[model samples]
Target: MPVDSTGHAIVAEGLRKRYGGTEALAGFDLAVPKGTVCGLLGPNGAGKTTAVRVLTTLLRPDAGRAEVAGFDVVRQAARARYHVGLVGQHAALDEVLSGRQNLVMFGRLYHLGLARARRRADELLERFGLADTGAKPVKQYSGGMRRRLDLAAGLILAPSVLFLDEPTTGLDPRGRNEVWEAVGSLVAAGTTVLLTTQYLEEADRLAAKICVVDSGRVIAEGTPGELKGAIGGDRVDVVLRAADEIPAAMAIIGRVTGGEPESDPDTRRVGAPVRERVAALTEVVRALDEAGIVAEDITLRRPSLDEVFLRLTGHRTDERAGERAAEEVAA
Candidate 1:
């Protein structure tokens, strides 16, 4: 299938899917432009993986329509498959096979000639920085190496769009960073990527735009900064030297920021959203000094993606991840 002239690598509307009594996807919608990364962020059972399956033609939606690389997912499933690659949560590789052998096998499975398959395998091994370790058995590879090999397998045909569903799950920080760098390199060469991740920081770093999914619907969509700004601009936090000073500090913060302040009594910390970032911090400091209150620390900073997610969804991404029966059904 050729790339879509509309410049959207993937598009979906009113997608609905159900597993038994659970509605995995309810009126889900998405549009991802070519040559960019779009992130789907949500807790378990929010329909992220279900949406990916439908778009990739692995699972059919009960209703609605979608297109990938100019082909309708349902009407032209084969053609759609030709233009997209999927790296699922679990590794889909033969542990007994070497990394290079695995990629070569994938190429041959796609009907590339043996010589062409070997060439593509070598190319990908070098491209993903696994040239030296390409001959090592996948079972002996590090977590990051196995994942990079999985990514290489997904790119045997140089797909136009790639769907990554929690690609870095269970990886250590170093392994995760290695995958992130590889992904960045791919995007630089103009591959459209749709990433679904529970890691807010991953989404923030990789996604050009983010869709916050909850209850099978997108409750918010924007760039990371825009999403953070949607809830509140910047925040001022002050830790008092003594627990008894929290009340006075909250009052000072409230007066300076002109917003209601929240306090953690146990930590003796008071914080509030402030529109004027630096000015509010300065005023709070001056007010505390005038009131003869000592502050252990004071700082003003933009809200984190985690804070934005909590504010929008009222829960963390990891919360209920293992408890969602609907997710189990979808899986």
Candidate 2:
């Protein structure tokens, strides 16, 4: 029997989970539209993994309800499992086997016959840009190749809802880009993806919608631009020629922007949010010149998703993202 379809690929309401006294999910709720990518973001220990586990049927929620592909996670665990797929932080691949073999094995596990498995493996290999290396040993493949194979295995059954928990965790810039491109291809084919990642840029680029979780619940949710707008708009930054000019610059910036300006002692730079980028920048420059303060640098910049995360979640996006990485992204 086919499950009834709905506009939402996944939905949850008032989900709660407790590990001893730790409340992992306190009334967590979300609704992801079908055929779109949704990014789940939060700081470390934010219950992101727990939420994925519950939705994938790996961990049952202590209370509330979740539906994936129109099947209840708890009551319809068996049915839900069939319509969902999971790709964890690490690439789940057999180093000794060739890429094709690994994918074929996944197909077989999903009950496809040997002939069908081979056909499916070939199909995925080509689709994921692994056709050239499909016959090579997994250990001989690049980090990106192996990650693509892991993603291919997950799609063997073409499950409607795919759970990606930090899918690009430790990949090099090149490798991460490859995986992202592959994910983009899948979503274009109408796959509904639930991505949990530490990269706000990733959410900004890939997620049609983003849900920021904190203390086991959603703190804010919106598109990347919308989230950034919630905190304010563009920012004007000025680097003083001398560190001693910080106080003077701060006052000028504060008065022009109607907001407190932030200072960086080391860079001798001052910055503040502004609604009008051009007007703010112009006013700051005019004021500094009249005051005989020389600014080594002055510019207006748009707010980054990083700023949004910090203002809403009470922590820097890099709080858990390790050292800041170079801008890594893909189609």
Candidate 3:
């Protein structure tokens, strides 16, 4: 289904949230087009969860406004709920209920007739590869199986917009891939999605556009390629034979590339960005030859999402101190 170009599936302007002394969201803004997947990528305590809660009408924002599926999240809470589905980090399943029953129950809750609900349940069971296990109690299912059932439950009503929060957090690699495949199919079928994840690779793989939140605000927003390109130019890696010659190699590489070469103290490797690959490589080789520095290996690579985050925030995503500070502020 083609979405209206003038309308937005999700829109927010100056959204803000506060918890006592903490500020969870500070003038946050977002716009997600219908039939597209927008990713919310951040480390823990970056307000990714809070933003999702507010947009889904689970929690109210302190300031600003938001709309979901053409309904105001606050003023038209029930209408917004009718058109959106949410799958949180943990599997929200009834242990005693069978997989098919779970989907039917949710379908009924959405006001579907018994016949239509059953039909939808059957379709979802088959689509999520849970047809064989549909009669089994959820308690008997594995982690992956339970997660799939939870996802199926969310889709029972054929919601127009889906909110997925760390959908693959606890799943194995194969399970994660399965979920990704399902998400891709949903987008192809014209269902918009808002995904939140701490995994950089997950965001890079699934998101058409990524919004990076840090300290309760969006610090960066763009496609994966755009964000990587923003970090500027290609990177060249040089592995030296001797650790002691790292400084000398850095000096040579830096002069050649016209950029400061960063050295890895542990691995004795050096890297720098270069605008002209061939010219920089030639100059680097010549300079290293004069300095008696033998390179064990040389390769050119593009910047990864990790490097992009580091460059933008001046810290890695896993840094506990920064996360704690953010939590404290958000709390």
Candidate 4:
């Protein structure tokens, strides 16, 4: 597809990369619309980091093409570099430098004049909510403060595209929210963002579109709600009064819902998929009543992103060892 001239911030096609014996990326493709946020999510070792590296020009792709901010990632790498900002998983701040000094240092690296660099540093200190701590050494800053400062450093050039790789890995709930708020503000002001995160909740809340990667390939892509809808309809959960009655409950639920019923051996709970939640609930309760099965609890809810991931990959995000082995082979 041709790149859009108006606001196509990033376009990548068939991007491939290898690290010695391992293949970090295998024909990966991505297109990020300008002025929007796209969340890249997958289990550990899913080639997310490798893809980001290639797009940001940190690592070269063996084959394929990519453009960032209208500049080719390979032939015009320097131009691409100037239009992008990266906030990596680790804080890239110098512990000995004060927050204000760190920002100023990055501004100078971006080739800003000394006077302009100092003015930008002051502006960022306030924007990132670090105005009061600007003079403090980074070593004395809290984890959240350091993270904010690191992000401020990336924004020194005011690049059109920003890449955030697990920006809130170890932060508290409040700290995470602060970062999320900043990201939201940036998007609102027309900055394109490509964010990779393991947190499903983070993707669900912030991503305009989500791309699920596994084994260095794009397995699925869609809006959060669209992916959930594709997994089927609402879930009807029935809790039995007696543990021994699980088998009996499952049989009745299957017949009533006309769908496969899954049972938990320990809790005597059964769940089935249903097209209509209210109708399914009513039918399940009446059927159980007729079968002489007592239901202790009943609830209906939509499928979560966790379930969606499992249904698509047959494994959850927390299944690390298997993913690592797959990644090693792909890499």
* The candidate that achieves the highest TM-score relative to the unseen native structure: 2
lDDT per residue for candidate 4 within 120-222, as digits (tens), equals 9999999999999999999999878888888898899888999999898777777778888888888888889999987666787789998988778788889
Taking all chains together, each candidate's TM-score versus the true structure is 0.85, 0.87, 0.83, 0.83
lDDT of 1 by residue, 38-102 (tens): 99987777899999999999999999888998899999999888799999998899999999999
- In lDDT terms, which candidate is top? 1
lDDT tens readout by residue for model 3, 226-331: 8756665567889999999998888878888987579997887999987787788878888888888899888776554455567888877666634432332222
Winner of 1 and 3 under lDDT: 1
**RMSD in Å for model 4:** 5.1
Candidate 2 minimal-lDDT segment of 10 residues: 322-331
Please give the TM-score that candidate 1 achieves against the real structure: 0.85
Regions of model 4 farther than 4 Å from truth: 1-7, 233-242, 251-260, 266-306, 314-318, 321-331
Error of 3 at 69 (Å): 0.4
Give the Å error, residue 86, model 3. Answer: 0.9
Cα-based lDDT at residue 234, candidate 2: 71
Candidate 2 segments exceeding 4 Å error: 1-5, 255-259, 274-290, 296-306, 313-331
Model 3 ranges off by over 4 Å: 1-6, 233-241, 252-260, 273-306, 315-331
Question: Measured by TM-score, how close is model 3 to the native structure?
Answer: 0.83
Clashing pairs in 1: none
